[model samples]
Target: MNITAIKDKYERPILSLRITVTNRCNENCLYCHHDGMITSEDEMNADEIYRICKIAKNIGVQKIRLSGGEPLLRKDIVEIVNKIASLNFKDISITSNGTLLEKYAKDLKDAGLNRVNISLDTLNPETYKKITTKNLANSAKRGVLKAIEVGLYPVKINMVLMKGINENEVKDMFEFCKKNRIILQLIELMNSENCDDEKFSKEYHYNLDSISEKLLNICDDVKTRDFMQNRKKYFIDGGEIEIVKPIDNSDFCANCTRLRITPDGKIKPCLLRNDNLVELISYIRKNESDEKLKEIFIKGINKREPYTI
Candidate 1:
């Protein structure tokens, strides 16, 4: 496997691509960043996304994660997954709210998705309804279990800890993941300019540093990822727990290894700062050659900088 490496100014190779499939979502989660976007209607079709992924693979990107307000909201999501699967990336995954997974889990697995990360804040149905403004917690739970049964190895659960919200459910979530063989990731609430609830983010910003100690104490073994903003992984019982604390952390920025593509087809370099994005929707729509498109990918890589440092 001969892979071309794209390095940033800090020598961090761009190995993962988080593509925002669409801005449209089924639920209205209060803490949603919408992929650092305020509002958008522009969404790339399956063909456009395939071309982008091909260009990305040619430049040494090995991992691809499909994200959205809800990625499965796209009717042609199966086709999109099939197209990207043809690229032969080492890993392919999707992050969703999990409301629709039960319907599409088997199809997605057959289409070459390697894993899945479902966003679930709390186990309490009332709290879930309050946070997401939707009573789909039971539906989401069924989706997670179905994803596991359908062979989506390491069915990860992403839980964003909020002070007055789901912070108290950390231990409970860990136990749930262990019983169900899910990977529980504790994420810190992100404060992005794109977020509409600035006061809510400020009031509920609970750092993961304070909770990591408790996790470490309960875990049996520790594992680590060379990539990812949250690199620490603790093995507990039959499940795994990872901590993601990316807000205002120089260490996180220094270890970061990702490039983002918005639903509108712009190559975003950093999630925290939107100024350095390289517009590519026009070029993509113009049907530019792969060589030309590769230039834009490199340009996006060159624009990468340590947002915290």
Candidate 2:
């Protein structure tokens, strides 16, 4: 995190960090949920996140995101966000399912949250029920609206578009984004270790090339949101849409800038790959010097390898 000589093997400097706060999600979207996890839900408490955020801010990690099974599910999220905000962070955001956001958006905003991203893959009620095994369409929709109401400008909707599923909503999502001034992010479904089960079918491949072609037709423009570099903010157009292709094995994986921290205190260097982590107490108790902690951050950064086809 320190900007000095802390360069990855590829020489890329780390900046943005994504932190997951909880593991218990309300809805288990069939495809994305995994069977393997320490379900006990044991991790750092509010005080721990506060201390970590303080350490992160001291070093040069300005942007921190709260993620999880659904960060809002944690009753202490508001306090956590408030504490993180009280740090030296330049941006504080949270990723949630939106089912619980409607009830907490105002409180979250009051806690110094700058933005929020909700996981909403389908708009059709039937498809939603089929996908999530629950009828949360109304409440989820309300959550998005509530986020918008609180001036969470450019409220982002993280839509994991899959073929034969919610892919057709591409155009509809852009139209919705244009009208509501929301940022609709059409992200390709990832190929995880557990992706091949009944949940992830071949019909869901959804080649980015084809999807982008069709999306360009609907979107007035599509912009790639760069991490770390702030050359551009939200991509603006008659219809602003962002396309994020999956990167399990892609050429530019070496430059992947974002880091994810799972709810149970497991820090994933990259979403596609399982790697090293920072055990909170162990790391602190070791009396690890600032430079060594920066090394831990850099070790993950250096692990970044080139992606293959």
Task: Pick the TM-score winner.
Answer: 1
Per-residue lDDT over 168-199 for candidate 2, one digit per residue giving the tens place of the 0 to 100 score: 78777766777787877767666666446444
Model 2 TM:
0.86
Report every candidate's CA lDDT.
0.89, 0.69
What's the CA error at residue 207 for candidate 2, in Å?
Answer: 1.9
Predicted model with the maximum lDDT:
1
Against the hidden true structure, what lDDT does model 2 obtain? 0.69
Candidate 2 residue spans exceeding 4 A from truth: 1-5, 33-40, 197-201, 217-222, 228-237, 249-252, 285-295, 307-309
Q: Put down candidate 1 lDDT per residue, 1-309, tens digits, no spaces.
A: 869678988899899999999989889988787878646798999999999999999999999999998999999999999999999999999999999999999999999999999999998999999999999999999999999999998799999999988889988988889998898988888877767566865698888887888878887998777766647899877778888886476668887889999898999998877788899888989999999999999999999888762
Backbone collision tally, model 1: 0
What residue pairs are clashing in model 1? Answer: none
